[model samples]
Target: MNFLALLLILKIGLSLALLVRPFMMAPTKALNNVMSLYGDNPLIYRLYSIAILSLCVAYGFGLYEALSGRMPWNVIAFGIVSNAGAALALTALNSHPKLRPFEATFATIAAALVLCALAPNYALMSI
Candidate 1:
């Protein structure tokens, strides 16, 4: 696959992992880590998880469209912007050192998505 396709696949995979993380961590000490990081509000945590899952669904749809040869540039652009904004907001709001790596990784992924969305032809040039 080309770079664009690869990036889309990566995005979908990461989204799936993010969607599953809450469920997988719920019964473990990771939930406690989440509570410590996010606060004692279970509602907030649930809402956050729902938001991530929603984004994941959107990304999945985008990936399907892309693979079908009808790439949805608008959806991809939205994802890039939203992910970048989320990364920036998280970095600004949270000073937790442990979360920095995740924030940076998300920002990097967002940057890659933006590049793919903006210049798919150039991005896929090698193919």
Candidate 2:
């Protein structure tokens, strides 16, 4: 309904999709495509996905608190900063075209989260 809520929904959706992608596309052509670009480190890829999923779950808890007027702004802020830093690092370290879009999307979402977290209308308090 509000900007914060919308951002939370977007975050959940993207995170869930990313969490499921490896399982859904593994052993298929899509996984092959990812492997070709990022190398065939299935373990590393799955671990990365799990890490993203964990972050997403943390954000989900923050969202719940936010909706209840007890938002953990500090945790959310930390996640936003972490996501931004990761995006920058990925952009700098990876020259693969396939990764560019992923990094861009992460940066975009992180920016939106930061903006929403800072918005006066959200009225979040630091933990």
Candidate 3:
């Protein structure tokens, strides 16, 4: 349980960090990389960043619900979708490779984080 809790905490930290990085924390070169993947300009990057931040915020909200046992099922569902998106992004590396290495790398890590955070107990529970 302690290990799982630790992993959860780590995931939370990483999610929040990556999600808010472009907006509040670090000024990442990721903006340019994300732009190269599927964006056109700074506005596009900001939009994308907003989406990422929103998902992370959602993840945090779900995490809280999970800990509270009131609504983990919903969060798990969202996490699964997030996982699938990441996996799709990762699989794209083998073909139609438009994303920069950093973008793909981040996607892979984000996918893994979603998987790890939601795997052990999330997959089995139902609403």
Candidate 4:
């Protein structure tokens, strides 16, 4: 019920959504057509999803420890970097007007999560 535990739960949910995005949202034809520059393949997207899945697993463990009243600093640190980077990347991608709404919304979510995590907490180590 602590704030850190809540944050970890949010992060795990986000990572799960990201991991399934390619499979659920991007139809094969769209992927092939839009990313033809990448040789009409979803390989890169799949790899990225795998990476997100890894983060989800890490966040799950962090949440477990957090519920036990332990601060998982390393997982929190990794989450900060990953979420911040995703926010920045999504923001930049929002330049494409066609994708602006989705990209901007997720970017805002990621940024807000990072800000919450960075807030003063006795459990956290130095930023």
Query: Best-fitting candidate, measured by lDDT?
Result: 1
lDDT of every predicted structure (CA atoms): 0.69, 0.68, 0.53, 0.63
Q: What is the lDDT ranking, best to worst?
A: 1, 2, 4, 3
Q: What is the lDDT of candidate 2?
A: 0.68
10 residues in a row with least lDDT, candidate 4:
118-127
Ten-residue segment with the worst summed lDDT in candidate 2? 118-127
Those runs of model 4 whose alpha carbons end farther than 4 Å from true positions after fitting are 21-26, 31-39, 97-127
Q: How close is every model to the real structure, measured as TM-score?
A: 0.77, 0.74, 0.54, 0.68
Instruction: Pull out the clashing pairs in model 3.
Output: none
lDDT digits (tens) for residues 1-127 of candidate 2 = 3556556667778767864566434654466575454455466666767777777777778778777666567656876887788789888876767767778877987887777667735545333
What digit string (tens of lDDT, one per residue) describes model 1 on residues 1-127?
Answer: 4666667677667766754566444643466574345444455556666777777777778766666666668667887887798789878887777667768877988898878767877655545
Q: Tell me, what's the RMSD of every candidate?
A: 2.8, 4.1, 6.0, 4.7
Distance from true location, Cα of 76 in model 4, Å: 1.3
| Residue 54 in candidate 1, Cα distance off native in Å | 1.5
Superposition TM-score, candidate 3 onto the true structure: 0.54
Q: Write the per-residue lDDT of candidate 4 for residues 47-124, one digit (tens) a residue.
A: 767777877788899878777777776776776677657557756653545444555555554564466556635343
